[model samples]
Target: MSRIWDRMSLNFLSEDISVKSMKRSKQKTNVLLISAVCLSLSACGEFSYKRGASANDFQQEKKSCATQHKNDADVDACLANSGWIVVSADKPLFAEATTTDNKMPVQMTSDDKVIAEKPVDPLELIAVGSWWKTGAAPNALIADSEQCVTELGEAHQTRNNMSLVTRGLVGCMSAKGWFALKK
Candidate 1:
């Protein structure tokens, strides 16, 4: 009778340990699943081409431009001139550092006052916007951009002077109407 009682108690304790272990495993799995979901949601966002501008204005201008220009570059220039700016939900639309007083921000210079920053080129803005939207390889874009800088002729590349020629490349793409769509 003593031997049987001892065996039964041992089996019950082992079963309880197994159940506790299983619960812990499930808890760990649930935590990991929740973390993964949060990470994915954070990465998700959309792109837009307006900040201070109205959507109705964009649509109307876009419709007119579509009818007017056969070339995408021409259309883009028209939109840009009309004050359409590229913006992303994930990033600040107007990230320009400014003082609270809203004065023209400038960098100290040796000479007379000069504006420290110029408005970022629309083409370059679109490049960043498109990257997040399309998830395309930047190397591929740079490869495609080689043709754009070919006209410049014979830039000496050195270890310290490695240049992407971004302006020329983005300009070429903009001329081709290769704007990135948001995901």
Candidate 2:
């Protein structure tokens, strides 16, 4: 009888331990789920891009482009150039991109072969208040602003507001068909 009781007690203890373990596992899962939700929400509002334009102007430009028989790319280019930017929602503008790339290219790879890194989409970059420039090689994006400084020439380096220099670089790149923000 005593031996039977001992075995029964052992079984009960094992069951208790398993129940506690299950509870802990569930708690951990809940914590992970909450963490994942918060992480996703943080990335939500970071994708809005805005230019110095009004909603009315954006609508008008979009309507005008609709009237034209231009391709989708041409319409987007017209809107972008006309100071309209793609926004995630009708949310208020947070900030304008004022960054300048002044770093000079230190070295180049020996091979002329393109590395084929994913071309960072310009709309996405603009949404995040960033910039992209065409690289010297075909299908290549200049990795950083050192090339911009070089392309702008030494005369631009002396400017009080480097943002203007950045604007100039962007204008130059846009004029050359490099500013097409992929829809």
Candidate 3:
């Protein structure tokens, strides 16, 4: 217990803040948080890409979501350039993407390989007991769900935000294309 506690520190909670500093922090935090959320959501989205198989064949796979963007502004610019319609007062914006390469930023592995699946965000599920409520989750995919929860726990042992952890779990399950079936 001491060893575990030794690795943990809550210094941020103790920091003093000036009114000006607090305002700046709030502004910066909001921007960063929104950007982070946008990127995270995009990671789970279906994007248009070359569709094929055979490992190297590499066409469209369900995991090929365009999640990586250099910045929020960059994404906006790309969207505008593509004229993909940002928001319409009328009509749903989402459609099954057909064009190859949605033109958004592409996340790559350390080996420079394009990441097909959006990596799970443990921070999104830091406090969830399991990926899904028992009996609500699909039995066939529970193994992956366990792996997801364990990964979240191990990755952020000190972090304990229930909502974030749950979101992370959802992201993990989404990345793996695991859908919880209705009981």
Candidate 4:
């Protein structure tokens, strides 16, 4: 009887230990699940951040090339003469413009064979704000001449502003039959 009682007590203690270990395992699993959920939520939030211009915003801007200036070479010359510097004459011509401070550099590119070439002062281009012009003899060649000065002043990152200018110039170049390459 004594031996039986001792065995029963040992069995109870073993069962109690098993229950405690199981509880600990469950708690660990819960912690891991919570951590995973939090991490996934943070990642999702980051993926949803805004990046580029809106479709409607683009429609509102005035286009540079009129029906007459649609020829590729003529368009290229028009842009180059207006202040866009040809950086690459390859399949996609690359070019850059500068801010008035000469501190920021905005680049542009073309899609097809590069014909015209010229050396440009990026700093002087930006300082004078010549990239923002329209008409046959535009003073400057801005994608949206109306907003060039305002946007540059409001831009927080000078480099980013440069990039925006470069993109606009590339688009103008592409319109002129020059393939604008992604930098």
Candidate 5:
């Protein structure tokens, strides 16, 4: 079974406060009820999973944060203070990062400083948005990206050969005049 079920089973076993004395049918009902409650409570968690700024940015930020924070909370705090924002569809904590036209200027605040003049590149701007199909091959995308990044003279690469590109790489591809096309 999955970790969720395992954890729920453990919880049910541990909360054997009244289970031992109950009849078998009553125990099954109790287990189901407890499981439902546990699932519901878990689903109600306030904290949402976060995707850090960009591929390049996250790597850099994580390297910076690693020295200071051994705990996940501390690391998250450090990243937040450093201006990293969360990008998740299941739970949205803030507004989308970019406007319709990425090249247009938008205000980006970092370390209490407002950057109003910098233009958001199409890739960076659309990183949280959409363009191409989601089922693209990793190798093809990486090959295309390498060609584009080299052309733009930007140094951004995937860490651990992961599926997604760094935000900087997206911008690099855009700079090289490549838009992610749908198949």
Candidate 6:
């Protein structure tokens, strides 16, 4: 009787240990699954994945023509000569031509300051706009010269006969040479 009782006790303890081990394994699996799901979600949320260098954000160290050259006017002239257009002033932005035929619009302030200018290909500008509107980047409108160019092109192509100021950005981009008015 003593032997049989000992065997039965041992069996019961073994079964309990097995059940605990199984539960532990299941919990570990659940944890691993949750971790994987969270990682995937985080990756999906990331914008601007695998993007190349952005010319829109010009760094003084890497992109500035000032130190190597002399004066803002000289730098501006150098950029203009290279076919880079000043797309924005507040941030000092510029764009290069994707093709030779396209010309950047000249920017003239009310105070008669010449800011910046460059030549830009029309089709390339349009493509860039479309890419911005539906690209993997975080925000499209932040550097969207293409949108302005496309609108201007459409206005002109439709023969809307709008004023140069109102003709949309594409037409402005299409004009012969763009310039940034100096302040």
- TM-score, every prediction: 0.27, 0.28, 0.21, 0.25, 0.26, 0.25
Candidate 5, residue 113: lDDT: 71
Would you list the C-alpha lDDT of every candidate in the order shown? 0.52, 0.52, 0.45, 0.43, 0.54, 0.45
Residue-wise C-alpha lDDT for candidate 1, range 7-117, written one tens digit per residue: 999999999999999999999999999998677545655223654657677879878987989896787667767756534345554222122355765666687865455
TM-score (C-alpha) between model 3 and the true structure: 0.21
Question: Candidate 3: misplaced stretches above 4 Å?
Answer: 1-137, 154-165, 180-183
Native-to-model Cα distance after best TM-score fit, residue 94 in candidate 2, in Å: 16
Between 3 and 4, whose lDDT is larger? Answer: 3
Q: Write the per-residue lDDT of candidate 4 for residues 58-92, one digit (tens) a residue.
A: 22221363334877667545544544432232432
Question: What RMSD does each model have against the real structure?
Answer: 21.2, 16.1, 23.1, 20.2, 17.2, 17.9
- Of the two candidates 1 and 6, the one with more favorable TM-score, higher being better, is 1
Error of 6 at 129 (Å): 29
lDDT by residue (tens digit), candidate 2, 103-174: 566576777564554532222222223334444553343422345547765543413222233334544455
Error of 1 at 124 (Å): 37
Per-residue C-alpha lDDT of model 6 across residues 49-167, encoded as one tens digit per residue: 11343545334422566666777667765554544443322432223333345556777678897645563434331212111222334343323434554645553332222112222
Worst 10 residues of 6 by lDDT: 125-134
Residues 1-183 of candidate 3: C-alpha lDDT, one tens digit per residue: 886665554443335345568989999999999999788545644222121324332222211322545564555445434422233223223221122454677676787855476654435433222233434445645576568768766653322323233555555665676432210
Q: Give the TM-score of candidate 2.
A: 0.28
Off by over 4 Å in 5: 1-135, 160-168, 172-183
Clashes in each model (backbone N, CA, C under 3 Å)?
0, 1, 12, 22, 1, 20
TM-score: model 1 vs. ground truth:
0.27
